[model samples]
Target: MYIVGLSCYFHDASACVIRDGDIIAAAQEERFSRIKHDPKFPEKALTYCLQESKITLKEVDQIVFYDRLDQKRYRILDTYTSFAPLGKTMLWNAIRKWCGPSNPENDLYHSINTLSKKDGKIFYPHEIEFVDHHFSHAASAFFPSPYMESAILTIDGVGEYATTSYGQGKDNHVTLERQINFPNSLGLLYSAFTAYLGFRVNSGEYKVMGLAPYGSPTFQDRITEHIISWNPDGTYRLNSEYFNFFATEQITSSKFHKLFGGPPRKRESKITPKECDIAASIQAVTEEAILRLATYVREATNQKNLCLAGGVALNCVANSKLLRKKTFDHIWVQPAAGDAGGALGAALGFYYHYQKNERKISMNPYDSMKGCALGPSFSNEEIEIFLRKQGYPFERLSDRELFSKVSDLLVHEKVIGWFSGRMEFGPRALGHRSIIADPRSKKMQSLLNLKIKYRESFRPFAPSVLAERAGDYFELRTDSPYMLFVAQVASKHRIPVTEEAQKAQGIDAVKLQRSTIPAVTHVDYSARIQTVHKDTNSRYYHLIKTFEEKTDCAVLINTSFNVRGEPIVCTIQDAYRCFMRTEMDVFVLENYLLRKENQPVLFEDET
Candidate 1:
């Protein structure tokens, strides 16, 4: 049976298709729309999934939306009514909600109607059902995890009324034991700090995490003492007076600014020591809270494994700490551990909850993500056709020859866009849709970022290493196929550089000649690594192996295939468009290779 899952009307709208218990395709609307964090219904993504799976809407046995709109609306109304004689800000928010195009019921009905129109010849009414938001997140986390039974946790900004949930999952069944309601959320607390620290809330949490390493946690006491109170039971309440999420138009109020001893930092401004300290303090606090929650869940469920999902679960630093704590023998985090993953969760939940199908526990030691290559892919014939039609000169090589050529290019310090197989489902670019270069190239990181990504300089690139050899490079023992963990680089590989080299070298300088593989290593001598296994992603593994044979190094710099503020490429056309827009030296789509010099001048005017 075919199941269609969807999450929309919130940021990172997405779709997923599941057949039996296996995922067929999953994608976020932002990828197709070229909009970062697009919140519209994922019509394009759904269309791609159906086309990729060769199925029509009518052929889908069930349609599941990631969250129940009625439940969410009820919570909103309840929260707003309780604050009656509502201030102007609250009144405006209510008005917008009641009449907004983003209203939950309106969006649901509109999405259904729009899909029906597109599938007019094939669709029938009453085909879609709504799943609870937190349940969807829980299912997404547990169903694909490598455990037969595990305790489940989902935490996000807000899903319907639940911002956080604790549950237990065994095989096909999942049961929720507790949940934290709206207006009192760890996600909001973090997001409030994100806003205060001059980053966009919801989207800027990662920035905060990245900046935390630069500062001391001097403000931790102030945060825990005046801003929020934590309970011994792993539940906490915020001092609402300092927060503006419920009653005010802003995320941070005047009191919050006053308490922080400054106004909100302006975007694009220089990062100060104060900002770093605040980021470090909040990050430390957030990790502590998550650890306490995980401990509580472990004791409550008596489960040896834990499955994590939701936006907060995407905090790789916290996840790394949790793994180190050993609260659970094993921990699995959904790759798309955000709202996008909710689409997949809803589908899995529908399969088990509504259909009552028995689930099979298959861990797939590499990870159940199937490399998360769940988006569209093109055949060599299609790519050649596009190249021919566009009058672009290209070469078609055998698989062995193609790998050899790309490997040689990497050895020469050339940056190549490696577009092969299916696009990834999450924010991460897992080899299939990646920009690759020799990790040993001193100039590669800066070259790729300044000329290609066009983003902040301090951001670091990741290393994709051979799975069997990962332990030799990183301080990690298990397979990190999803690139979710941040571990220290093995000390043996550290590079020694003079203080003058560091001072003269900007964030980009850290990219050049600090180590044997200077491009991918961070200033801290660590790399966020993705281990590639042949069985899980044969093509990517072969490419990396070929590179290793050519250079005697088993690692390469890998970053998402997109520019700043854009979603990762999804379609072959999107990949081509990005390749043409960037300074990448070559584009490898399947067995076809196209050179930048031979292509039309599509990006001549782009900054």
Candidate 2:
């Protein structure tokens, strides 16, 4: 049986199709829409899934929505009603969103029918299955994991009434034991700080994570004292006085600004020491909360393994702390841990739990994400046709020749846009849609940020290392295929900072080279790592391995294949446009390589 799952009307709108127990296709709408975090109905993504699965909409046995609309409506009403006159504006907006002409709850059937109309054929499922939001998150975590039974934790901003849920999965069944309700969310608290620190909420939390190590956690006590009330059982309540999420669209309120000693930093403004300290303080608090929660889950479920999902699970720094503490014997995190993966989770939950289908674990140790290489792929013939039509210069080489050539370019410090195979399903680029460079260059990080990514200079790049050689370079001893965990650079690779460098504060400290792989290493001597497995992405694996053979270092700096505020490049045209837009030296589309100097100058109005 074929099942289709969808999550939309929220950030990272996505669709996933599963056959029997296998995920056939999954992608976010932003990839096709060219809008970062497109929150509209995922018609294009759903169509792509159907096309990739080689099935028509009529052939899909079931359709599932990630969260129940009624539940969300109730939560919105309850919160807005309590906040009343003060929240009049927010209340009207909520009502308009739900009762408006474009309401998702009212138009899902129409949207689905409209998209499936090919050759004038239109079909809708008998009934749409609505799963609980947190349940979808939990299922997304437990079902795809390589665990027969494992503790489950799902934490995010408000999902219906639940902010956090924890339990366990055994066999095909997942049990959510307890929950923390909305208005007391750790995710919201972090996002509040993200906005206050001159970043976008939901999108900029990771920026705060990246900036944390530049300053001390001097305000951690202040944050704990004024913002949250903690319980010994790892449960906590937000003070709520400092927040305006319920009363207004803004996340933080006047009280929050007063406590912080000022209003939020202006967006795109220069970083200040205050903002860095705020980031460090919140990061420290978030890590402590997550550690406490993981400890509680380990004690309660007594499960040797743990599966984490939801937005908070995206915090690699917090995830690293969880790993170092060894709260569980093993941990698995969904690559699309945010709302995008909720689509997958919803489908898996309905299949294994609701439909009573038997579960089959894959022989692959990487679980069932298929290395997240589940998006659309272009064959060499199609790419060649495009290159020829555009009159772009290119050359095709065998895999061996291309790998050797790319490795040689990296040795000469040439930044390359490497687009290969299928695009990734999650926010992370992985190797399939990555801009790669030599990690050993001290200047590569800033160069990529300013000239290539056209974003903040302090944002650190990730390291894609051979899976077998991961521990040789970093302290990680296990797989991190999703780049979801941060590990300290091994002591052997770390460099001692000079006295002057040590004294540098805040963003200035980013200039210090803390490790041999300076481009990928953060100011804290930690690196977000993606372990490339030969079994998963052999081409990328061989490329890195070949580079390692030449340089005697097994790591390559990998960042998403896009500029600031854009989704990762999804097509050859997107990749080519990005290559030409940036200061990149080379572009690789499968076996074809085109140097910037060989390409004609692209005019802004040409397209």
**How do all models score by TM-score?**
0.94, 0.98
Residue-level lDDT tens digits of model 1 in 360-460: 76656645677788988888888887778777788999999999999998888788999989889988999888999988877777788799999766677
Q: Which 10-residue window in model 1 sums to the lowest lDDT?
A: 504-513
Which 10-residue span in candidate 2 carries the lowest summed lDDT?
117-126
The best candidate in terms of lDDT: 2
TM-score for candidate 2, residues paired by index: 0.98
Backbone clashes in model 2, listed as residue pairs: none
For candidate 2, what is the lDDT? 0.92
Provide backbone clash counts, one per model: 1, 0
Question: Which sections of candidate 1 miss by over 4 Å?
Answer: 82-90, 93-102, 117-127, 496-514, 603-607
lDDT of 2 at 582: 96
Identify the runs in model 2 with alpha carbons over 4 angstroms from their true place: 119-126, 605-607
Candidate-wise lDDT, in order: 0.84, 0.92
Per TM-score, the best of the predicted structures is 2
